[model samples]
Target: MRIISGKYAKRNLFTLKSQKTRPTSDKVKESLFNSLGQFFAGGQVLDLYGGSGALGIEAVSRGCDHAVLNDVSRAAVAIIKKNVALTKEADRFDVTNMPAKVALKVLAQKGRKFDLVFLDPPYAKQQMVKDMTAMKQLDLLNDGALVVAETDDQTDLPAIAGFDLLKEHHLGKTLVRFYRKAAE
Candidate 1:
């Protein structure tokens, strides 16, 4: 798949060949960003389940200052690095090869707070709610931070306190859910 919009719009990205990884298509990515926001001014983004770093890189191309991309698979992480390299702005990104939990902890320790987060974990093994909860406890989310979850049609995201459900869009069998953290 490739970036649909932003500075990296039309740029191609690399994805793993394994069936375990499901890369978001250009059409769905377009719909997802359109619903969230066409672009951003300056903010940090987190791609917690980064398969190829496309979402994070797209955020940077759209004006976000920085992005942190993480994945558990080594091959996926390598592909993410390659994709980020294509942007020619690698300094705008931090690539981490680690499990989501470890990545979150490390980012928290570094005092990283994100304005946007993308969660597209495997549909069969989802821990999105738990991940978001940890983000809250670790104080990794900025006030009003936006979290987007891309999942299969069968997956239904439950309501969580302190977050407002902003939008939901269905592109074929893909389900996209948007949420905004409440400010204290």
Candidate 2:
């Protein structure tokens, strides 16, 4: 769709026409950022299931300094590159085509730490808890980082040790959950 706010507000983006990926809707994206307060100061963002790179790009638009958009599909990664290029600040983005776990490990090896993370896997393939645990173990999250999880309403994410449930928003069939990592 398009960016809802910030520098790229209302800018149209590219999306995959495949049924394999679902882009977050503008309404849900708005509500999601609203819960975190409008724009951010500066931070790193990660979208492991980078469908069209929309979520990560949106975060950059809303003040995050950098974003890493990773997808298992090369096609999605290509679209992610195209969308990031549209920002005209290509240096702000890093696109990788790999399995989510591999990307996480690679980022960890590179000593990357993120302030914001978006976990919006395919509705039926959600593994948020496991993913969060991996991130925690990989030391990829900054203290007090925020993790936004978008899933089908049927998916209920439980409380993990290092994170506190911040809020939840139910928008029709979709459920968005926010969690803050406990400072170590």
Give the candidate number with the greatest lDDT: 2
Per-candidate TM equals: 0.96, 0.96
- Stretches of candidate 1 exceeding 4 Å from the true structure: 123-126
What is the per-residue lDDT of model 2 for residues 100-122, given as tens digits with 9 covering 90 to 100? 88999999999999999999876
| lDDT per residue (tens digit) for residues 67-96 in model 1 | 999999999999999999999888999999
Clashes of each: 0, 0
Instruction: Give the C-alpha lDDT of model 1.
Output: 0.89
Against the true structure, what is every candidate's RMSD?
A: 1.2, 1.3
lDDT of 2 at 165: 86
TM-score of model 1 (CA atoms): 0.96
Which residue window of length 10 is worst by lDDT in model 1? 121-130
